[model samples]
Target chain A: MAFDIFHRHKLTISGTQAQALEMARLRLIWVGMLMMMGYLAIILRMGDLCLLHHKSTAMLMGSGAPAETERPLRASIVDRNGNILAVSLRMASVYADARMVHDPAKLAQELAALLPKQNEADLFKRLSSGKAFVWIQRFITPKQEYAINALGDPAIHFQEEQRRIYPDANLAAQVVGYTDVDSNGIAGIEKFFNKRLAAGGKPLRLTLDVRVQHIMRQDLAAAIKTFHALDGTGLVMDVNTGQIIAMVSLPDFDPNHIGEATNNEKFNRATLADYEMGSTFKTFSIAAGLNSGKVHLSSVFDASHPLHIDQFYIHDFDAKDRPLTIPEIYIYSSNIGTAKMAESLGPDYIRDFYQKLGFMQQAPIEVPERATPLYPSPWREVNTMTAAFGHGIAVSPLHLVRAASAIVNGGILLKPTLVMPDNPDVPPQGTRVISAATSEKMRRLLELVVASGTGAYAWVKGYDVGGKTGTADKNKNGRYENHANISSFLGVFPIWHPRYVVLALLDDPQGTKATHGFSTGGYTAAPVVGDVIARMGPMYGIKPRMYITRDSIEKSMKPYLKEYKEGQALASVSTDH
Target chain B: MRKSTLLWLILTVFCGIALFHTSQKVHDERARLAALNASIAHEKQSIRVLGAEWAYLNNPRRLEMLAKTYLHMAPLSAAQFIRIDDIPLRAAPAAAPAPQTEKIAVKKISPEIQPRKIVALERPVTMKTRKPAPPRIFKKRAAPDGGTATARNFRDVMKSLRLGVE
Candidate 1:
């Protein structure tokens, strides 16, 4: 009907009426176009919000409210088996805009009441300082944050920060280290791998097995308490891979409160403290002798009496007062015999041997705390003799462990590492330090030490345990103190197929009733190693032999044993106990 | 001309309805998507908190203390472990038929003695009178030793339960 009316009007309309109708039609068309454009814009905006620009918008939202969704700036540090040792948890830190405070003194007093550690006066000074922004406190607990948030202070604001938390507390404190409030690593592996960890991809997988670490720490702590030692250190490493399964230092500080720790607590004895690891170094000397082809298992060194070299007299700890075969020298830990062997090899060979064992330089580990070996200058004859018996030269326990690994693990001196290698099964192809035959003989000698000699306490019942003991007098003011001794034991288990090297040391250990008043390595450190092996062996999948015995070790060392003359009287001196 | 106008009107109406429905569907889906994204963010936050809590709970020191206090279980030692093949085989039972019931307490023989409580409570059910199917997912398994896997009775199940409790 409208079309019929329009048709009739069109037929009867004059030019003026037609022009008015045309203007009205054009206005309606323009209005319709404008409405369409508005709908199209709405559609485009919906598309953008849903698809094209959604991520950018979400990012904007996330940045504005980062406390809830922000990822950690630093990745977590986990053990080899994916157990978390250190993690960066998102935490709200309390900060203050001092310029925005209404009444600085009043706000400061109120905040001081909330934070018990802060005095009102100090807080007032901080708040009234001319600085526009100041940090009131950092890494506050959620409860404290809530308490402060409840204050409704306009001047105080919370900033989201990543707080490094060591969930295991002091378990691997010296290895994992601690980060500063600003999330900068200052010590240990955290400092060493700061760049990669801060790059933030996957969790940093360390080679440490926290279970084994706990075992070592427990035994070392117990030994420290029992012997009344000043401090103790323990380490366990895989012989083939050089992966540190466990590293422990007693008097350790909780990484969460790294700032509160004293210098003594922060001292990493395992890696940083260089000690004259007395008789344990004899293994290296004898191995060097064997490797240089100057000595064999039957090589004899007359250790009947002390040898006077200039003003210094090199005396055997357990003087046999008779000729001892090379293996006997190792098993008995005859210092004079080892020094004699070193004298024959000369300073050049001895120094070369030490260098080959990676003992002449700083420890090649992933931790920042490392000690450079106190290598004797000029390689003089006296220095050579003392270094042979492990007196004149000093190296960290980690250095000894790496060299020990070379002696028993097929003569390959692998670089000790804290991070688990990508391929752990393939052993590192390290520098050849000794012949395979020499390494085998070294294993036999070490086993013999645990079997019938000073390391008898380190003998685990089921495992093929083998190691040497070192009881060194503490050097004080350039003189060796008789009473103060660092007793240490370096042990390897399943010696036939060497796997783990465990080293335990007690600093200034005192003898106890349990130890029969003997503070030597054989008495103090060896038993701790035995306890660790007994507990950690089963966990490492080492089966205990119930029926099999190691009588063969005795048979192999028979050539190294000598018969005493009837006229020669032997005095029983138990120096190592 | 009239047909074309009608056709145009139909096309315009159809197009208008299609666009309106499409927009409505898009709006509904966008709302759903936003809700899902919000929930995912919430869950991620929860997961992060839970991970931290898990790490704290699994701390070796705390676990060791707990084990020392409550469990009293020392770390597994080498001596305590044995290989599976080390275990010896058991001896065969004597070739004799077992008695159906054994008396726990002996009494004087009397004709007037009442039946024991255990013996009086049990009754045998024939296969025909028993329920056809058991609630458990049991298959008609042929025993490896060439015996039929017969369906156990309710009495047997109850006896097993009692044994479990004991």
Candidate 2:
């Protein structure tokens, strides 16, 4: 059989037939080989599917859920107590495919009815413009979206967009700030932490307490109305941590309606606008004097007459007309006494002291709307005298509050912060601006002011309130206007162990009948500070020491106050400047 | 050889059927998982909206207004607070002996006290069983609106409720 297979076979057929038969045999062999190759390919593919491609196939089939929804475009902003101040919500922005819209006039009418703010004529123009897409309304309410959807038009559609919402409205308008339509932070802390907020994780908690903010705003607003002031600002700060608990700027605009706000309403007076802070600066000058050992509480300064320095004459608003002890000088708000005290300390020492207290530069706070303090350059002798009386220099209310906090909070000058720290239990450290002994003496002297001096109106029974009142004539075009003045008060309560520092300022306050035509700080702003402390004392759970009496405060300050009379007919109304 | 070929053919058919069934089941599960994910996303969005609304509703200014209108309450005054030590202690009760015994018994049963050790294993165990105490009876009192017969009137009930009787 093997020999026969090797032998060639002969065929009895014509040449063409034999050739055709040979071709047919070759084609059949080719077809059979091709079929074997196809089977082999199928086996290889089956093996690949069962082993090499298993993971890919399983992933494709099993992971059918859509990729995780995108994270919120912006994070929320909360108060110190975790109350929502600002949030970002996914909202429906309705638009139209103008090319597909039919009866532009009719559709415009329907949309105008649905959206009261959208004008019918404008909608018709947008619809008839033949543009492929046009926005009908942005950030519509859910009810409006529902109503529009009921129209059931194929041309109309909605695109989900992120919108920033300020839930507290005008309560914390200047601090929480507001965002633009594109969810971009525009002002206040919103503008300051734009990048961190855009990253979108946990909420950005601020140091503000909304309840305190409400109280401050309500009280400040009432004071503004009562005194007929043009504008006002208020601030509250933690003495140790420098956390701003409440900040209010009057004539503030609602963040929810940013477009309707005027430029004046948008101005953050507390942190941005600088003013000649009048008598509030006395707290700093007295602290500097006491800290430098240049002037003790018992030291006497001649406030009997105006003192001449260069072309300017420094005079007390209500002249004491006698050599005044340091405590009596502070309580009387004597400008001449303060100027003489600064003169004794010299200009260099005063400038360096002010620099250490952070008065020479912009206030160090979290908000971006901070103002650089305006002070005389070259530190002239006259500038030192005027500055000691809170003139020839200007600073924001925030700066005053921060400095006052340092003076009352054991001499630690902490940088004010609007954002709460991750661990609020640990207080941020501060630089020492004065000796603790000096701060204690300053506390006693301040309490004495409220006890029997010009700031007598600021006294709140049992709260041991201590403060200084200032009434500064506003400078306009380099000239001081007498009638137009800034009245302010700096208050610290439970003065023995201070916890909070509050400052209230009124711009161009007019005197009312109750004030007897005197719009000085003692008559106008001191009462406001008193009211704020009276209410805040209870809200903060600070137990009032009924044992603390005016007599006790005066007795403790007796060594510093020479010939201080008891129940001295509450110092004349316009006694402080 | 024919038997083995037949056996392999049957096995391949069974494997094919099983693979198809599993893939089909996986597809159904993926669809359900997708649906759940969608609903979860929706619920999260709604919760954010509700949070915003809650903040707006709880705004201090609004709360103050509501409180002024509906609640007869004023802000806490400084006079309301007093030191804890200022509160005088209550006078001694007339029936103090019974409470004294109970206090001693509580001390005896305290976890801090260790049980006495047995000196000898041969001692017989004595189990003392006390008599069960009788259950106290609670008597139903008349409704604040005089009686249930007259309490059917809704206005009267509302008036009584407003007066804080119920």
Candidate 3:
């Protein structure tokens, strides 16, 4: 029985081994099928890549459009009338990678043909320096860019850069100013408000009217050409608001090409050049005397001869050599009479008046280029005498305009500004420089200067123009040069209630035949003011009173100037020099 | 394997398929959003460029020159304007004519239908008798042509306007 059981067990073991072998054979077939499926997927993928669209993605990427970039925008600058003066344009600049450049000389020669400003030798030196990257040219024209792109140089690249553009060109160059290549403000209102311009949002709106600026510039250039002067400047200020309407300085440069402009072309003479603005100072001195309550329009000052003070003799440009009333002194522009008036008022009172007028310090204007007034260190009688007639003290034409504004615009001294105020209707409560009564009197006096005095040439038929004429000898090395003088006219129009003060200056005007060998303010600058008023008055909406006469203004000052009229008529008939 | 294990396995496969499908959909949406952002940036850049061009085109110097050449107009002057109060009411429009109506044929009407004479209406006697002043003289800014025509064609229209005004 044991032998039989052993044989059965052997048979069972063989049966189990044969069943396990069958299961292993079936599993091997399944594994073979899985391997075959994997191979099928790999072959299908290779076929799809080869037959359908090989390198489709690589081509799409290689010919892709330029990578998107965001460049910071700079703000625009506009005039008071919303005329665009300066703008920033997004421009493409070409640059090069020296490491990637294979043939520096050839590439540089090709680039030089496109960028005419850069020579081939310089470009080759830059490209061969082996630097990582270098700028080739900035703000290239579209045609130049297209030409450069056709070169197909792998190392050459283009980048969008911000470029400052002045659309008005040299219209208001000194005021609107110019910017550097890096889009930074460097002069004029641009320099004054540089950071605000860089942090770009809204445009910088100035208080300038392009039309008015054009008119002023046209008239000023004509006057300069006519008078044969070196240069000229003209400014129009809204006396009530202290807003500069138009400012023009001759020999101005185009802000777009600031690098090519000469230093003289870039100099802003209106606010930077200091001159001893001759008899225009008499207007201030008379106002000072009137405001001090010690002198009246009818008060008389002795001017029998040239008064010798220490080493100086104070005399008129054309001496009357007689005792004269204050009105006569102003109309005749008598230096001796004004000196006597200044002496009577004392140096303290005169200096105080000048300080109140902002003549002792820098002009309070919205420009970076400002000049401090040159005055005597210590107040003396001789300084007061010369300063009374606009000598011994130097101030810019802008300073004279501001001081004249205070004297004419109801005694309120306001800071002149390039930016318009938020509320122009609400009168700015400025520091008081004179009484309203005194201002009224000063208006009449200035009108006298225009009606029958030195500024007779500045008289517009129906605009009630009032002004003073100043012919200042050009000082050279502390000596007054003969035949070279600054002829300036300070004018206030519709003088009954003054609204605008215009200053026209001709620097070193030569004598002309038409002017009869006179290069004085009345001949050169006063006529310019008149022409400007005649044109701009109608444009500015100032009505023309067809029938207004000198009698209308004379009625107001009849109480004080009854005796001075006869003498003024004789003196003003041929008043040009 | 038990039937419950097979059911659990089937449920897990379904969840895996749903998550995979959701992830694919999210990838497609992200790509579309990226394309939209890029297009928006391009549009903004174009807008900035257009704005700059518009400003350049509208520069005052260029506009003034255009006005001078095409519009034939001068800048407004103070003399050309008057106080609003000076513009008197326009004569009450001169009593507009009555609207027309269909009428019987005059030639065919009978003898009893003879036309009656027109009567004029009388205004109120209390009205003032002030005569209107003549219009102020200003240089007419008549367009040379109808604005789209060339400069040489402007004179005929201007002459006709002058004749019409007269």
Candidate 4:
């Protein structure tokens, strides 16, 4: 009877419908859970393959191309003298896949607390957003990477990126501007040559000598601080070859931390700021009158008092009581005398001279980022007089160097340059804007200024140096501030041969008790040029010759000058009549 | 049946002769190949010996020492690195002279021939001096003969001393 009952229970047809429905539901739920696990496994394997492989397709990590996962290539930058100036090496940019992020709030808190720089809330917000990828930190330090790696978060990933490093910290900061977080050039020569860097080729070489650059930066920076000055800029150039060996601008930023820098720190004052160059402009004006055959070395112009114009007085810095010879005018830096000399030449000739010197044009270099010189629109009598003493016109230090090089480089004008291998040391394609004779007289007169006049303190013992001291009153609010002067010194070395030209300017240098409470070119910027010349003299093999005799300066002029007997007879009538 | 058996015997003999001739030809080719292999081995041994000699002669340290002592010169100074702009732009650098191929004359010493000997001899001079003061006592002489005969008067002397000396 029990066996028969069990057999009957196995065939209970009335309950089989509800029993079959329950069994099918259980099987369907199990199948759904298995499919979901399989999809999760496949997604994780794909992520592992992509993150581990630094291939081009793995560029989902972002920032230009895929991060260089293994032995990332570095780009090099070299100076003119074949020295390494800056380089970009392989470094890690740590990121995370928020979709793979486990305990997002906890990981973000850990990273934020560890990084010290980023806010925990912001990191938590970005991490919890369930993104495929997000940059937690870029250009992280090696020590920081080790600490983050120790946290051992499987979701966190690292993408190797190139980080720029300037070995010579502040030497050529303005010229070799820094790169961004993703290693893209943003300013200066670095920006100018970014395309060459992206290809991972050899480092782009510039025409800067890191040694000379260091000397300039050190000298200018010390002067900038000593005078309690706002800013400063300095540049040294080869007159014959038109190579910028050294250039520096103060209040410069560290290229490593470029993003945090202000505009003043990033400003390339040497090539960007155009200032009224004061008596430094005399170098060009004298070159004009002498080149136009309107004046000779013995030609006399009166600096007896202020030269009265239409409601304007062109006064001299060191006014002479009577008429002065051309040499005396330069020796004294007589604004009134130079103004008369400019008046005699006429505005058309002066403006043509400026145009020839490239002063009316943009900064002539390959950097592609430079300010054009501010010059008089039409050459007027007032423009001629004011421009004579560096009042009516303003120019960048690069233009000033270019114009000075033209006046002294045997009268052959050459534009300045920054690139090296491509230029191959070719001098600028410039015409003879001045006679060789005028250049020689200008060199002698310049030497006299350093030896006996305003630039007397800038004299180097053995280096036959010549220069002009310019202490121009800065025009702040349409009127000049007497106390706030832009002191600059335009100097050349071995004047008999004229090999190098230097210009150092200090902006708003205040008077100091250390400077006898006087902030002029001689006190503020002249010493910087002198210091650069002293340091670079031996480096360039420009030794103090045993004899830079007067005969040497007098010898080059012999080929083009006549005796002053004719000029002296005319000088009496020149002053009286 | 008799003709079939005779034909079978003749065919077997021809087949045996053919195998013998073919074996002789195969042996000849094997000997030639073995000789060629021996020649190849000889060439390989010669190359190994030459390679050993080259490794002996080419020591990097020695070459570096030689370069330091004689061949290398210091780099030119910036004063030496003149701007192309500074140069007159008229001429290029001078060319080096052509390397000479010197022919060294060898004096062959034949292995089958005897080497020429260099002979150096002292001249024999006999001076008859007056017996300076007769010795108070005459010393006994072992032999008065100062000729080649006396020189060869050891335990085994040659009878024809003149011929031996010559």
Candidate 5:
């Protein structure tokens, strides 16, 4: 039985070995089949590539017919009224790979002659440096490219590039800005609207008017030259829409040759330059009091002596005494009275009010270049006194605008913007700081400044002009400069209806003989506002005002005084901090 | 069995299908590329048109005329406008119109002089030439020859338009 079992086991083992051999044979057959299939596939693909197609993909790529790129042509930029500000023009940029060049001297001579800017010897020396590649020229003119192409050297290359051409050399330079060699925005609205410029389907339209820009630049340039100003800035904004129509900065750059401009020439002063904007801050002070129900158009404060505090005195160019009315104080721009009113409103309320007015924060705009207004980290009493007269707290011309805009644009606080906001369907939301009644009264007072007070020279007969003049001594270290002054004027025109905000500022302006050795805001800046208004008003179809009636203003003031008097009698005695 | 012939047949069919697909891919890519190029070309053409318009519009003489004609805005004066303030207010007309008499003048005409009268009217040659220009010399002869025929043809056409030609 054991011998029989052993024979069966041997048979079973042989069967298993045979099965394994069969499996190996099948595996070999499968491998052969796979190899045959793969060989067939490879042969077919190769024939299809080398024979059937007649051209390889690599070869096709080397040839220019179907290059794997479909770059969109760049878009043009226009103004609000469809004036073309900046537009992308097609051109060629030339470069050369030294590694590919056979004759360095020959290539250099040809390139140098084609581009007269470089010497042939210098070009040859650069090519002989054994570098892999060298840039011959960027943003070459079409004629230069043609002259280059006539050389017909194998090593020479031309890359298609976009060149932004500015039609108006210096008009709206700060507004349109200039593009870099690679067509990237470097400053102004171009820098702000970089992504939109790149996305190429739709043109970016600004609120700038080229004609208006020319008139302004022409006027402003004359002003800068006349005043012996180190720098100057001017802006016109649509108070209704917050559209910056035209913004000009002195020492302006040429967009066509923007790369050649210095850092100072490129700075946008109207929007980015910051300074102690003097008594212009007073507009906010009175607005705060009116909003707080503690003051009225008839409110009085003695302006004869400077409002004296611990080591600080706030007084105007000419002092008044015996309790002048609010309109008279503003018309005269009495810094002493303004400081007292700011005290009446107190620090907390003023700080909060400035905060709501887009001050004490980074200015809002699409452009990356924006300066934050310098406010006291700890709001104090002395800070309040200086801030009231616009000394301690430094702000940009834009801040002065944001504050003054509210006073002119009814009692509502509208955040100023660029880019003529997308929603034409909806007007921008603004917070009401003072009642319409107070706003009406303020308009009358501001107009009275142009008509009868410090800004008297700014009065143009036909226009219902209203504006405030601001003159501050520049701070060298901490204290204000007695000689070097920043003179600025903020104005709202057709002041009865108020549609536009025009601001003019001159930095370190020297007094001229015509100005009677005066560089104050009224003398230096107010006249510019008046000229801009007279020039722009008729064009905008704002018919000239035949008369400056004081009826509506007086009516608004009577009601304002009675309400404020009752509130003052019953209000909290101590709201100051 | 003729295995090589069968293999050749399958390979031929496979090669044909692959070629069709590759051809289709190339054609589709070409169509896409053409469309993209066309679009780029169209954009470039449009920009050229806009630039031409801008150049024409921004001509200095044109702008000066516009400033004068529109808005009573004149060349900036030293007396009316001092050099102290030049902040630009861009609410003004950017490029003034052609200042056509039509553009600036109101249409309220006084009925006193009955406007300028038309002196004379040019008479057309009536199948006869008093004075025929060189280009129309042949036309004068042709017109005389074809006048009766044209009048009859027009009568027939009018009949045809009335649906009676058939």
Candidate 6:
């Protein structure tokens, strides 16, 4: 066989050459083993990262994530038409770490220049206090915040805060109320629904109409100024729904500046203060009599002289001094006649009637500001006589308006609400306080007052306006003041089908030239109610009937007023006397 | 065996490049998503501020003051409102025949009456021609053909309503 170099395995070389080749193969095997071990270690580490350590690695990579936007701390308060009454806005509050601040005096001087409202001395004192942190100023404007930040002081920092803002300001102040610096609601509907507002969802909708509220305020303020009266209160309510459309109590305070408000300005007279509602209570008295079947429109009462009960004398402002029918009594606002009517109804029956009208307790409304009515506790006979003409018992104007609404709104006693119901199509459930027939009769009587009697100034020709005049001598320290009286008019328009009940009251109104030096409800407040009705009529699109004359009113009221013609003859005779 | 090793090395390089590219694209998309979310939050905040400002500007008291200063208008009075039934009906064309004798007398008095009536009729024709021009301009700006058809349909509906009223 020929031994060739190509077939090395078959040909054997001896000694050192063969041994060297074997050593080279052994070293190559060792290096290959080391490379395989390194690859295996890399595979094991990758498996560990993919299985158990992935979450930790991802978190480490995402450590610099962006922050989410924050929502308002409190929800907004809107009117019935979605007009914003109250809202919360984000603001920057400036604070300083006293320990980090190197030049407190220089920073204070700089901050005072930026914030004109903040005093330099006060800022320096707070900044130099050895405390670690101190608030320099709260709720700084955007302009001031930008200027202060330009100072570039690392010691000063900004804290995000929420501040409540009342955009409508003094327009709906009492109803929307104000909040404390810590964003806690302190009064009115804010305090009433604080938890719901703080939870932050949709805006809280109220039953107030901004347009109607403005109208009432403007008219009431004009009347107050003209008569030189103290603070006045006005309200408008839907009789059918018992929703307060507008409420104004002046001297109203701007909710934005709650710190500067006086105690009297904070007092909500519409729902909180109680007053003897004066002759406006006669509407309830007659309604009570009619509902009880004890009094008819044709029933007659003697107003020939002042009634003597205990030591009190109940005298009519314009005494007829003759027998007057129920319609005549209401139209003329005869205190003697109403007292006689209440005398027939008796004390227990009158008290029960008033209690049924929610007059014995606080007015049930959404606001926490309310007052319990003050009536005679013993329910004596004299109390019945006095309460009939709205003299002894005292109730808030809201209570009077709610009760008056029931009397004219088909006799259904509905709870008054400042918050609008969620479903408007569904009418609120109400308790029937009187028969619809009695309400109809009462409507006719109210119309008669505007057509021919003391509430004549409240009449709008086409609106068929009807109401009563009340001039109550406000009781002061248990004694009724002589010249200081609350003159008010409770008005309902289109009395044939009553829609809205508007009341305007002036506290201690003095007589003016425009009112013929007469500060009674008819002279002072009735025209305001009439003007408000006239302006509001076109807004509500209520059709005005040019054909609804006084003749037509008298004809419709003929059946109830059988003695009306006779009473008219007697009235003319008394005027002549 | 060397050829197979070379092919395996090329496949590993391609796989590594693809993995790196995919991860880089995912990282860029995540950053973009965060930016978009931040912008959306900013827009929502701006909308809230604008709504508050709108309510403040549209306050009835402020509007009334502005109207008093700038506008020549008065509050609507009760006398200004009238029932639709109270509107007097248009004089029938048949009543024109009753005026024919007076027209003949006027014609004898002055030939100028004929030209005056012609001018009055021409005024309405000019107005009618001018009315369609504005809608045509609007159509040119909106869509080529669809806007014209819709505008014509709107005009036809308006014309029919006017005829019904007449």
The most accurate candidate by DockQ is 2
Of the candidates numbered 3 and 6, which has the greater DockQ value?
6
Q: Mind giving the per-residue lDDT tens digits that candidate 5 earns over A1-577?
A: 5565334455555677767866877898999999999999999998898777865654664433534374555677777776666777767788887788889988888888778788898888778777777888887877998888888887779988777777666777776778777788878777777787877877787777766666667677788889989988888877766667778888888788876888888888877777888877777777777778887777788777766788876666665455666775676676777778878886687788777787788767656668878888898887876776677888777767766777788777777676766677798887876678878767877776665556665676657678877888898877666889888888888887998888888888787888778888888888888888777875676765443433333334443332233212211101100
Please provide, for model 2 over B1-166, each residue's C-alpha lDDT reduced to its tens digit, 9 standing for 90 to 100: 6999999999999999999999899778888888997788789878889999889878999777544433444676565554555543322233556887657645544333323422222332222332212222223334444553233355754464455321
Top lDDT hit: 2
Colliding pairs, model 4: A76-A203
| CAPRI class of candidate 3 | incorrect
Predicted candidate 2 versus true structure: per-residue lDDT over A190-266, tens digit per residue: 88999999888899989999998998899889989998999999999999899999999999988888999998999
- Note the residue pairs that clash in candidate 1: A304-A321
lDDT of 5 at A352: 82
Give all candidates' CA lDDT scores: 0.80, 0.84, 0.80, 0.71, 0.70, 0.81
The per-candidate count of clashes, in order, stands at 1, 0, 1, 1, 6, 0
lDDT of 1 by residue, A101-192 (tens): 87988888788888887789988888888677888988777888999999999889998888888878899998898889888889998999
Q: Candidate 4 residues A1-577, lDDT tens each?
A: 5465324456554587767756877898999999999999999888977676657443443333322444434456778655566666556788999998889889988999789889999999989989999999887878889999999998889887767766555667788876776677777877787777766666678888776777788788889888889999999998987889888888887776666778888888889888998888888888899888868887888788887889887786545578887766765677898889998997677777888888787877766469888877766788988887788788899999978987888898886888774755554577787888888878888886675556766666557788888888898867888778889999999787988998899999887786677788876788889878866775677656434433454343343323322212111100100
Candidate 1 stretches with Cα past 4 Å from truth are A1-72, A143-147, A548-552, A563-573, B1-42, B83-86, B94-166
Point out where model 4 deviates above 4 Å.
A1-74, A109-121, A141-152, A423-428, A546-577, B1-166
Residue B67, candidate 4: C-alpha displacement in angstroms: 33
Worst ten in a row by lDDT for model 6 chain B: B130-139
iRMSD (1 decimal) for each model: 4.1, 1.7, 6.0, 20.1, 6.7, 3.2
Chain B alone vs. reference chain B, TM-score for every model: 0.52, 0.53, 0.50, 0.33, 0.32, 0.49
Task: Extract clashing residue pairs from model 3.
Answer: B144-B154
Between 1 and 2, whose DockQ is larger?
2
Residue-level lDDT tens digits of model 3 in B54-157: 65566556665445544445654334444444443323212344333113233333334233322212212222333322323334344444444234456754
Candidate 5 CAPRI level: incorrect
C-alpha lDDT of residue A83 in model 2: 92
In the range A298-378, model 6's lDDT, one tens digit per residue, is 899989999887898888777777998898788778889988999998668888999999999988899999999999888
TM-score of each: 0.78, 0.81, 0.75, 0.64, 0.70, 0.80
Model 1 gets an lDDT of 0.80
By summed lDDT, the worst window of 10 consecutive residues in model 5 chain A runs over A568-577
